[model samples]
Target: MKLLLIPDKFKGSLTSVEVSKAFIAGVKKSGIPFSSHYIKASDGGDGFMNAVAHYKACISVQVISENPLGRPIQSYYLYNQESNSAYIELANASGMELLKPEERNPMLTSTFGTGLQIKDAIEKGVKNIYIGLGGSATNDGGIGIAQALGYSFLDKSGNRLLATGASLSKINSIDDTDVFEGLKQIRFFAVNDVNNPLLGKDGAAHIYAGQKGATKEMIKELDLGLRNLDVVIFDKYSFLYAELPGSGAAGGVAYGLKSFLGASYCNGIDFILELSGVNDLLTKEKFDFLITGEGRIDEQTLHGKLIQGVLALGVRKNIPVIAICGKLDIEKKELKKRGIYDVFEIQDSTKSLDYNMQHAADLLTAKTTEYFGLLLK
Candidate 1:
């Protein structure tokens, strides 16, 4: 029998590669006669760079950049010389993980650091840029990124304003006189997994600002600012992206890039799968079973997440798909309805959360062994 294991990072525990290794060990321990192939996957979030770096021979470039809070830090991106392309994850420079609980404030954060990385890559003569727009800490609607690229946001008095969530409403005009000339030569692809619009209830501020430390009043203010910016963008660029799918990704960075940089958006998982050549493998290889998973299995997993993408592939191939997760929150019947043949959770109910997380690799291996052993019997 042949099995394919593709899993996302277990978040605060094992990486996708580590998860695959643990499962492979479990299969061996079960004494099952099987050949296994595995791939590390990410849905354009924190592990995006690692996933791409695993399959591509690339050079790492490090640059000095500011964090969301304007603090200087070192960030890096992967560059493929052969393709003249660069892969950049916004999380590396301006993600929520970089801020402390008390320091989390969307109104004060910016995506300037992410823009700096892109600027460096552009200066390096890359013709293609793939930007992962997840795990961001800002709600600035990409104004900071624009500022970094030589676009000035000016007030009614013609004074330049600092690009931030709180300052979006004060902008009277956008000037691109000093914008980089090479931008016209490069193609920008924004990799995202969500389809939220740029404004309204399902939009950037209303749906995501609270998590970035915004209160009810602050969310309203941010939404207003986004609406104001939307008006300006439409008047100047004649493109109404506020209602477009994926415009809300990265707190409206997707929309901003689309309007300012002529960027195209694509699903993160699909992009990764294509870039890794996994789609070709799925078409040519036959497997007895396919296993995929993430940290948690819930209704959200049915969206454009990594597990769902894998399940879709399994469905097309008419192969049973199994999920092994840290926690299972959905009913088995519900998962079955979505074409998942089985689901397994590795946590011990008697254990504390810390204990389970700390020993996730061992628990995962044991659980996989036990489950496959039963299957073989």
Candidate 2:
């Protein structure tokens, strides 16, 4: 039998390639003769570069950038040669991983480093850029990114809008015509999974601002600040992006890219799958089953994530698809109706998150082994 294994990262637990390896080991242990095709995949989040790198061109370039807190830090951007563009996963520079739990203040953090990375790519003569907007620790409404591109945000008193989410309220004017003179010909395809707007109940501040240590009061302030800025941008440029899907992504970084850089939004998982050559691989091989998964399976997984993307492809090709997750939530019927053949959680039994994370590899191997034995029988 032949199996195609393509999984996303189990968040803090394991990577896609790591999970595939465990499954491969379990199948071998069960004495099952199987031809396995492994596709390390992502939803254009943190490991997008690694996924494409496994099948395409990936070059890492180190550049001086800023951290989530506006501090100078050095980070890398991955360049893909086949696409003739640079893939900048925003997390590499402005991710929550660079900050401590206590430092997870969206009110104070900035995406300036991400802007710097874009500038570096522009300088390298890359005309197309793909950006993954996730795992950021900022709510700056993309002010810092605009600053890096020479779009200055000034207050009524003519002072520059400072580097913080709270400072977005003071914006009185914007200048983008001459900013980043070398970027006029560049095109940006922003891969975003979130559909939140720039400001409102379901906007960036209210829905995701809390993940970055925003309090109720802070959420209110951020919402108002972003709303005011949205008004100004629309009045000046006649571009109303406040309600655009994914506009609130990466703390409104999507809005900035769309307004200033003429970026277009695309689903993250779809982008990754296309860039990784998954379609071409599937055309070259036939499989009895396709196994794909992520860290968790829930209602949210039905959204623009990895498993659903695989399911779509599987359905088109009339192939059965199953999933293995670190944790499975929701009704089995719900998953089955969605064309998922089965879902397995990697935990041996119920335990604390810490324990589950620590033993994920072992538990995953055992479960996969048991499943394979049943298949063999």
Best by TM-score: 1
Which lDDT values do the candidates have, in the order given? 0.88, 0.83
Error of 1 at 230 (Å): 1.7
Tell me the tens digit of each residue's lDDT in model 1 across 1-377: 79988888888899888899999999889888999888777888788898889888888999999899999999999999989999999899989999998999899999999999999999989999988888889999988888888999988999998888988888888888999778888999888867789999988999889989999998999999999999888878898888888899888999988888999998888778777887788789889998898888877577567888888878887989999999999897999998999999999999999999999999999998999898788
For model 2, the superposed segments whose C-alpha errors exceed 4 Å read 30-33, 80-84
Q: Per-residue alpha-carbon lDDT of model 2 for 1-377, expressed as tens digits?
A: 89988788788988877888888888888888889888777776678667656766678889999898878888988887666798888888888889999999888988889999999999988889988888888888878787888888888887877767988888888866659887779989878866668888878898788989999999999999898889888878999998987898888888878987889998887877786687887788889999998887888577566787888889988889989988888788899999898888887566888998888888888888898888888
Maximum-lDDT candidate: 1
State every prediction's TM-score relative to the real structure: 0.92, 0.91
25: Cα error in model 2, Å: 2.2
Q: TM-score of the candidate numbered 1? A: 0.92
Candidate 2 global CA lDDT score: 0.83
**Stretches > 4 Å off in candidate 1:** none
lDDT of 2 at 197: 80
Clashing pairs in 1: none
